[model samples]
Target: MLDKLRREFTLITFGLSGVVLLIALVMTFVSNVTMQNNVTLSLLNRGLEVGHALNPQMGSKDREGTVGADSMLTVSVDVTPSGIVLNKSESPVGLDEDALDEIVAKAVSGSETSGTNWARHLAWAKKSTVYGLRIAICDTYSRDVSLIRQGISGVIIFLMSLCALYAVSRALANRSIKPVSEAWDAQRRFISDASHELKTPLAVILANVQILQRSKDMSAEDMRWVGRTADEAEHMKGLVEDLLTLARADEAKAGSVGAAGPMVELDLSEIVDECALEFDAVAFERGCTISCETEPEVMVTGDKQQLERVMNTLVDNATKYAAKDSEVKLSARRDGKKAHVTVNNKGAVIDAEDLAHLFDRFYRTDKARSREETGGFGLGLAIAKSIVDAHGGKIWATSDAASGTTFHVTL
Candidate 1:
């Protein structure tokens, strides 16, 4: 239980932190891309403004003062609408004539006033001027490289931050759950101690009541009172025994009581068959029948006595609640490495809300039903679930009007 709590805490914390970090990284990337586009377009516009005087042979110093040092790599062209280059400026990097023609052709044919040709690492803008169609192209290789580096760095940082958050969240979860863990331990200890303390007195009371009922001189009225006392004592004893079983299950789950019992390979099919036979008479008394269908040699590894208890509890419960003249079915099968057992009965459908909490301690679907009517304190399913969990298996139930109620166990 504590492990589950810790895992949930870590996941929620790490997940929320990851989302926030991802958003920040994405926003930063977008802002940088927007800023780079604006700067590139501004350089292209400046080059078009000075189209008439953009001499191909102009020195770097002269052009630097005119359109900034970064704009030295810009290519300005004066082209006609029919795709003829009228005049062009020299590229500092010495781009060939074919490349320059392709750049001019793409810029002139573009529908937008400004756009980027990402394949060639260039940004271009065109405007109709008195000279001709003026087109400006700027190198975007350096800007693209910067953005790529930023993206890689952001990904690395996000991953590293998630790792760090996992550690921090785990530590915080441990600290947060410390008090609750202590309280839970205390509760389990109380139940174990109280149940142990009650057992002897309950036994003494029952023994004395049995002796009183056997007295020869006792009147019928007094004998009736003694029988009532014995019945009530018996009921209390059953409750105490259930509380002790739960306490032991709790201790086993917490790993404080060592192993629940010795685990060994056992034939699950035989156990199912045995439980069906044991409950045959009980089901008959309730006007229900027991049916068993088990695959031969179906096996699992678990404590034999505990597994028997689980099967007995399930079969008994089914026999009690099954509709009159209906069948209580018990089946066992092996599927690869896992074994499956199911106890199904035709009876009134358990509501969805009640089905979900069926394994919770002391949870009954019919709250108005007395313990005498139900013949249980509602801990049988919870005990079965605990045993299954200890064996690293699963147990659950499903109910509907047509199918009635079915309890399933996979080991």
Candidate 2:
């Protein structure tokens, strides 16, 4: 239970963390782009300020003068052959070639000097005359710095959120499932205790009943009642035994030695054949025929009694549920290292929905028929599955509406 809870908690935490990280990454990317745009706008404004200041300094003879007060700016008054060249302080270059050209054009057009603080540029015309200005303007945000910041912050936040989510999810899962685990344990204990308590008295009652039934003085009617009582007691005994079997199987308990109990290594084909022969008598009484097809000398290592019980349970189920005079086909085959045993019967088709759960404990395909003919508590398949499972095997069932149902066991 704890393992299951922990697994689910881990999955939930990781799943949520993945989603959060993806969103954070996208948001960070957008924010980075926006920030870069803002930075570009700032650079443009400084350029325009330079251009504006240079505009007043431009002259026909000297060509240039100081634009700003700080060492960040230097105005070289140069009269070149074609024009006056004025360069502004170092500024971030525009992102693309087009933006670069636009910045230069803005400076040359005197837009930077006359424009707002958002943009800046250096302007040059002829050698005798040129002006520069710094202006503020609007443009798209730059992406570089914002993206890097967002990436770093997103990674940090995602890691922290994952840790927090995992811790909280684990705690929540434990709390949410604790009650179920407790109830399961309690139920298991109650069944174990109750089954234990009932065994001794049931043994005593069976002993006394048997002793009484053997007496010669009893009337025929009384004998019949005693016989019925014995049969009912045996049935009850079987039910309790099944309960114990399932309980042990579920709890993964080892089996104890007993007379008429399973213990042996034997040829599975022979066992299957014997089970089919034995069921032939009962099947005949029910107007059902039993037959088997098996590979020769297929062997297995397990409890003989339990294996017999498994086969009998399958045959009994087939005979009980199959239509009148329907054939119950028992088959066994060796495929490489494993053995497969299947019982296919012609009968009313099982519903597709029910097939998935047919092997569940106390599950019945036909509840009314189960009550009438077999008086079954729906434990035959469950017990068979338990026995097969104890022997490290598997069991499953399949049904088709046009055909019938086939139950298969692999060992």
The model with the greatest lDDT is 1
Question: Scored by CA lDDT, what does every candidate get?
Answer: 0.87, 0.67
Q: Write the per-residue lDDT of candidate 1 for residues 54-120, one digit (tens) a residue.
A: 5445443444354456667677889888878888776675556766688777767767788776777
RMSD of each: 2.5, 9.0
Task: Supply the TM-score for candidate 1.
Answer: 0.93
Q: At residue 111, give the lDDT of candidate 2.
A: 28
Q: Pick the candidate with the highest TM-score.
A: 1
Off by over 4 Å in 1: 55-66, 91-94, 130-132
TM-score to native of every candidate shown: 0.93, 0.65
| lDDT of prediction 2 | 0.67
